[model samples]
Target chain A: MIASVGNVLVWMVWVGAATACLASGIAVVTLTNPFFSALGLIGNLSSLAVLYLLASAEFVAAAQVLVYAGAVMVMFLFVIAYLGGRADAPWAGGSKLFRIAAVVTGGALLAETLVALLWKSSRLSHSAAVGPTFGSPAEIGRSFLTDHLLAFEVTSIVLLVAAIGGVVLGIQPSPEEETTA
Target chain B: MSALFLAATTEPWWISLIKAAIIINIVLVTFAYLTLAERKIMGRMQLRYGPNRAGPFGLLQPIADLVKLVRKESFFPAAAIDVLYIFSPFIAAFAALSTFSVIPWGPGWHIGGYYVTGYVANVPIALILIFAVGSIGIYGFIVGGWSSDSKYALLGSMRTCAQLVSYEVSLALSVLGVVIMSRSLSLVDIVDRQYHEWWYLPYAVPQFVGFVVFMLAGTAETARAPFDLPEAEQELVAGYHTEYGGMRFGLFTMAEYINLITLSGLAVTLFLGGWHIPGPWLQAYGPIWFLLKLGALIFVFIWMRATLPRLRYDQLMRFGWKVLLPVATLNAVITAIVVVAV
Candidate 1:
């Protein structure tokens, strides 16, 4: 009876988080204000983090909030605030053809997701059993060092290159400034 | 009387709820008195009596302040975004309050036939969880400033955003040394490792560099004096919450103090061997020791505020990125190498 109650609670949480994720994801694109859109994105990321916690991937869940919802979104808010009145609404002036293309692409992705969900649900009645240390930091660190070593190194290099690119872009003289110089 | 000891994971849900209730109240009371203490201490430093009129030695100051704040008219700026302007303080307070949940206040003890852990929740990634919740707290300042529709508020939030983001890197990096030595991210495990180590010394000795960087970065992260560029009063007129009044403003203040308390608690847990006394005979009074250490760290925070002048904006940025970040990174690297070798 206790196990059944626990299962019911877990299901309730999963459903609530999933619904919030979808709602916020839609809100991100639908919101007129840039700040609101960013807020929506944060909401979406946070709800997704909740889902990750529900899945018992505690490290990934925390990283999702720390890196994306926290650091990256703050930067986005910073830029939006800096731009202030000049920041235009997303896709506000896009061509009709572009909007159509975006819709088509979104529809395709949604269909693919639905199909995959159905396929997976048919194959497995419950989530696959994970080992005791499956999502622990130590296990994750070991996996990154051994099984995913190359991928990990590549990711670091990519991040380094991105940082350099950002610095270069930031230092570049604007067109008007260059002409004067 | 039967007694049963339970691990953090095995404890029942109601027990966790009880722990949460107790912790929240304790933290809130501490926060209320901390404001009073800060004022009194600062007043003493500057050669003035602070709030002596309120309930003898200003014991009732916090209560009086609460009453005034609650009763005051909550003035909203005409151009402010209503939804976010109102929601931002709660967001900030929520982040600050939740970060305390994972902080283990003491070693677990059996009480009345039940084993109760020190913390509300003992997740595997408790350390990262604190940072994650803290990051969310940044949004409160940012959103509050933006929603207020004031340039001063906007600039304040911008400064807050940049300062916090820059300092967080060094702050997280500085703790890597401790995580390496302990080989676990859980606060309880870290404290346990410190207690059980052969030398009986906290990580503060071996990872002194990390400890210094952690404290410096923590000061910046909490936006206290010397690093409080975001709310530099002369420049920004109270910064992000310039337009906020009444309880709305009070919430922001509450969040800041709570975050300060949480940071001190974390420092004690990470560097000072939380709740661990040198002698085995004093083990039963673990919570008292924990509180004593936590209070000392908080006093240091207030002392720093009284002592140091605020840093210049450019100096703040330069110090965080150039000096603190490099020192933290280098310390982490050296610690990792030494750990691997020995």
Candidate 2:
């Protein structure tokens, strides 16, 4: 069998990075200030990007960084600001409900990871049976255009409407009473 | 799956270490000089010599700046949230640094007959990860603003968050055309498809609207001019990092250049036939040729910064939602039709 050593290191880094991200993700909700929580989430995300890199997912890692780290958190920041939530934060302590939710979610994640680890080899490799390549750029592009064309069109229309809505919202002054005060 | 099954296998740690070192060095060196180049160009644009004394024609300026920043005292805002105030820059820097792992700087050429991937990450979804990192970067701006504990900083960072989130969809969707045309998420694969014919001019032509959206939003993404409302120095006295001095501030500064370089690299890879040296005559230039192409893309970024006036906050938001986003969608639709038919 034609074998190479790239596999072991990839798995090790991939698992290590995923662990770091999940650990930090837990810290996000645990952290005191919303700002710190946001920072923790960013830490969690970067680790995930690193994990993606380790998996030989070149495009996904870049997109992970660009869209999630670059764009999505921007939304979080905007939402945090528009709310004008309190900046003075006390040390964070979980409520009974959050702790329970965390435990349940944590259990689910562990179960999934266990399955993934055991079935790792089968799931890891992609076959080129469909064509000369699996997930080749050309094939993905054609599929996106042909098979998923309707969804693509719909996404565009939705974005267009959203853009118009944002403009309309921005132009309208906050209900006069708030502005006057 | 073939890529993943190899996990049971292992490579020499030294080779892996060398590759990791390469990734780190590229980001740091690129960020350092991007600042120097921006200054030199901006200086020339305004008809003045910039950093001439630093090193012959300011070649040594970025090196000097790096030393100065490292030696400078790191300070946190007194009234700020102590720990996060300190951590925001690293969060920013790390978010910025991770974007480079997937970039295909050149073809995995055989150096001494040893085939190399030429990238740190050779994954199935490289582009998605890039955008994801970009999203995380928003948290840095938000944290910096909130940690600064100042109204101006808060407002600035808040603006950044909003702008990036809104603009990113259009950016992603716009580039999806390239994804559709190229069918691969790996930037290397994208470039491979383009080597025969540049995707930008043929398939990506109609998708220029996305490019416009991407460029504008990406400009905002890095928190740079016109879209640079997050750190609107004139208004916020440096926005999110207003309270930061020394090394903390250096992180913010470095993050800006890194974002710029990363964006340009992505742009070149997706739309500009990354590392595909132009000219049938120039094919011999090889990877160095791609570096040259990257240089030109970087120059355009600095050029836009110098030429374009800063966008008003309201105008920035309005343009994104009203102008770029709609145009991007329209472009995507049109390109899909043309691409499918062809």
Candidate 3:
């Protein structure tokens, strides 16, 4: 009886987190004020981190909070604060063609998800059960050093390139460039 | 029935709740005295008496200050966002308290036929868990500043956002060296690894560069003096909390000290062999040793506040990104190489 109760509590918490995740995600896109939208994005990211923990991906959940919610969202909010928290123009005032394109894209996504759910998607089904080591940092470290070494190295290179690009774009003009201009 | 339920469960939930309440209350009382300690220490450093009037040797100062703050009227600027202006400081305090949950206060002990751990929760990724929660506290500064609708407050918050994000990289990298050496993400496991080592072999010895970087980055991360551009009194007039007053303002002040204590505790856990006294018999008194290391770190924090001058904003950014980050990364790489070679 106690074990069953514990299992029920887990599922309840998971459902609550999922609901919060979806609500905050909708708020992110729908909030008129950019600052509030950014806050909504943070809420969304944090709830997703909880979902990741529920899925037993503790390391990934930590990364989600550390990198995305903590760093990336702060930068986003910083930019928005400088710009002033102006509400976006109403959707009706936007270009008709742009609205149509957005609607079409959203509709397509909705249709794909519905079809997959209703038809019992084979690609989504997997027989193998996750083991004790699954999603653990040691498992990740092993894969990174062995099976996924090439991809890991490539990702680092990509990050390096991005850093360089950021520096090149953000730096002030040198004395020579200023003089020339 | 309750007995059967307790037998079936791995976690003794009631005991954990009791422990959490004990820890939280202790932290609250500590936060109160830390303010008194900071002022008294700063006063002594500058050759003057600090708050000696409130009871003998200023022992009652924190309680007196608490009462004074509670009695004062909370002034909300007309221009401020009513909701966030009030909510921000709560978030600040909440973040600090939440991070305390994962901290292992000491090894487990048996009492009344039941075993009890020192901490509330001993999660697998306790180290990163603290960082994740600590990062959310940044929102408090940002929201507090931005919601105030004052130019100085806005500028202060923006400075805080930039400064914290910059130093966070070095802070993360510095601890990466320790995590690499321990081969574990749990703080308890890290402490266990250091138990058998000699006195001279703290993780800080091998990763001295990382230690230096950690201290520098940590100063910036916590917005301590020298990196406290966010509330630079000379320039921005108390910065983010300029518009805050009464108990609301007190919360932010309390939150800073709370962060100070938590960070010092973490530094002890990561570097000073966490709660481990040398001899076998003395080992049972782990909590005392933990407090000793934690107190020493707090004293250093206060000492630095008294000794150092605030850095220029641009210079602060330069140090974090250009100096600290590269050095920390190099230290991590070297540590990794040695770990692999051995």
Evaluated with DockQ, which candidate comes out highest?
Answer: 1
In model 1, the runs with Cα more than 4 Å from the true position are A85-90, A172-181, B1-9
Candidate 2 chain A worst ten-residue window by lDDT: A127-136
Top model by TM-score, which number?
A: 1
TM-score for chain B of each model, two decimals: 0.96, 0.90, 0.95
- lDDT by residue (A95-152, candidate 3, tens digit) is 8898899999999999999998778767566434667676778898899999999999
Q: Distance (Å) between predicted and true CA of A29, model 1?
A: 1.1
What lDDT tens digits, residue by residue, belong to model 2 across residues A1-181?
Answer: 2333445655677788888898889899677656546656866877887876554454455556665655555566566666665545665557989879989998999999888878885765663243334444455567779999999889999999998998798885669867798
Q: Regarding lDDT, does 1 or 3 come out ahead?
A: 1
Error (Å) of candidate 1 at residue B2 is 31
TM-score of chain A of each: 0.88, 0.63, 0.86
Candidates' DockQ values? 0.51, 0.36, 0.41
Q: In model 3, how large is the Cα lDDT of residue A64?
A: 93
Clashing pairs in 3: none
| Model 3 TM-score, all chains together | 0.94
Residue-level lDDT of model 2, residues B80-102, one tens digit each, is 87776777788788988888877
B265-308: candidate 3 lDDT, tens digit per residue: 88888887888865566777778988898899889988999999
